[model samples]
Target: MRRFTRNAAVAAAAAVAALGLTVTQASATSLDTWTVTPGGSFTATATNPTLTVPAATLECASSSASGTLDTGSGNPGAGIGTITTLSFTDCSVIGIDFDVTTAGSMPLNVNGVSSVANAVDGSITNIDAHVEGTACSADFTGQVTGYYKNDTKQLVINDGNLTASNADCLGVINDDDPALYEAVYAVSGGHTITLD
Candidate 1:
């Protein structure tokens, strides 16, 4: 496997930490653009929405990058955590819920990507999941869907619950029109959320 840039790797790592994906392989900076459908209902209180983009360019380069989800209102209560050697934990995961909705085009370089949410207290509930491998081609879609137990440090999923969705449009795209690359999405609506 080719070596990736430190910054890109760190950025990718940051996304992994935030999105909860354990990437075994590496790739170039994959671009992901999405838009929220708006008028959607969510029962989970989302906190710190995150998305990672590879630092490098192209699928052959072996780079990565990412960004966090926002309220479509240009406001993220707290920024997503960066990937580091230290096991960095989200400062306020104790009382946070998360939900996501994305629509647009995404092209990935690798075969599969993952996301994880671990419980700090070992008794609380969070969410995490890994996406299965898919062919590298246009019009492909795969979803790495699941929930984690933050307090319990465990993952509880129902039938076919761990991997909820999949498609070719899941990964990141390389070069696309500026307008096409633009993403719009939102993560909100949670019962556990407590307004300060």
Candidate 2:
């Protein structure tokens, strides 16, 4: 009876080890590599994009962005891609029609990707935009937080760490005033990217 009990215990330990091994193997599909399937270049268009400062705010009806991401494999770190161009259209700043330009701030860094189900959390850093209106001008620069959902292929720019400076309009945007930039971009050309 003692011999039989010992054999049963040994078999149980083996079974547990095998199950652990199987689980480890199945979990190997982590975000180890990222691929930009159809193409590397992608274009994104936004709806209801807006930029707000303390004094003035611009509510844009339409916006668009274009950028490229490199094919990174095996534990991708920061700087995997960059946003080459960003444009805002049909914007009104304090009742004055205007447009926002990110001049000299092109190629914004695409920092890193966080693990999420069917989606990747993306952070777009180094945001700098120049807003000019009928009688006002300001410069906004800072980083913004956003996430790219794989299911909808939408990159939503919501909360941001932005600041305003060099205000000439009046007193709406002061030097070092906190700012917020918001937009929802639908990405295209780079179909269904996987960041894992």
Candidate 3:
């Protein structure tokens, strides 16, 4: 009787294991590498703007920027990528034509990702804008908060701030001052993109 009981218990355990009930695998799938290209042209505008140069306050009329978004093999919800060939156009200061001629890249990351919504909010950081004008040229640092929509393939920058040092500007304006200015940017031109 004792041998029979032991055998029965072992058989039940074996049956449970054989049914594949011991371990479970996750059903969720993570996104791999993907690239987003602009489908059409986009624009950005500055708000609550203040430009302190030589004690002069100015506001930015508008900003035109475009770039490609790339995510190199990682989870879309929490991943890091780069924006290449990012350019700015028609950014003015104090009613003067301010042009950003130097093209550069920006570091981007996604947070609070929602697969159901098909969207991800992120930040654009470490932006080095090489700006050139008739009177002065300078390198400015930019930070922005934006979102990406999977359905529309659009990346929008709703709010942003730009800062530049007197030294970075080559002593043209604000030669000894560093100040923060408001800016807005977007990218949505008949662009093409691939998600893998």
Expressed as tens digits, the lDDT of each residue in 89-130 for candidate 3 is 455665666665434666666654545366666677777665
Ranking by TM-score: 2, 3, 1
TM-score of each: 0.18, 0.73, 0.48
Worst 10 residues of 1 by lDDT: 79-88
Q: After superposition, how far is residue 178 of candidate 1 from its true place, in Å?
A: 19
Candidate 3 Cα deviation (angstroms), residue 66: 6.0
Off by over 4 Å in 1: 1-42, 56-140, 150-196
Judged by lDDT against the true structure, how good is candidate 3?
Answer: 0.52
- The digit string of per-residue lDDT tens for model 1 on 1-196 reads 2355877898888987866443422222122222222312321222222222232111111112222222233221222111111111232111232122223422111111224332111011122221122331121123222333333322222212111233232343222211111111122332011111
Quote the lDDT for 56 in model 2. 64
lDDT of 2 by residue, 1-196 (tens): 9999999999999999999998886555332456555547888999888888776678998998888776544434355567888888899976788868996434333334545566665667778888887777788887887777777888888886888888787776678889888888999864555654
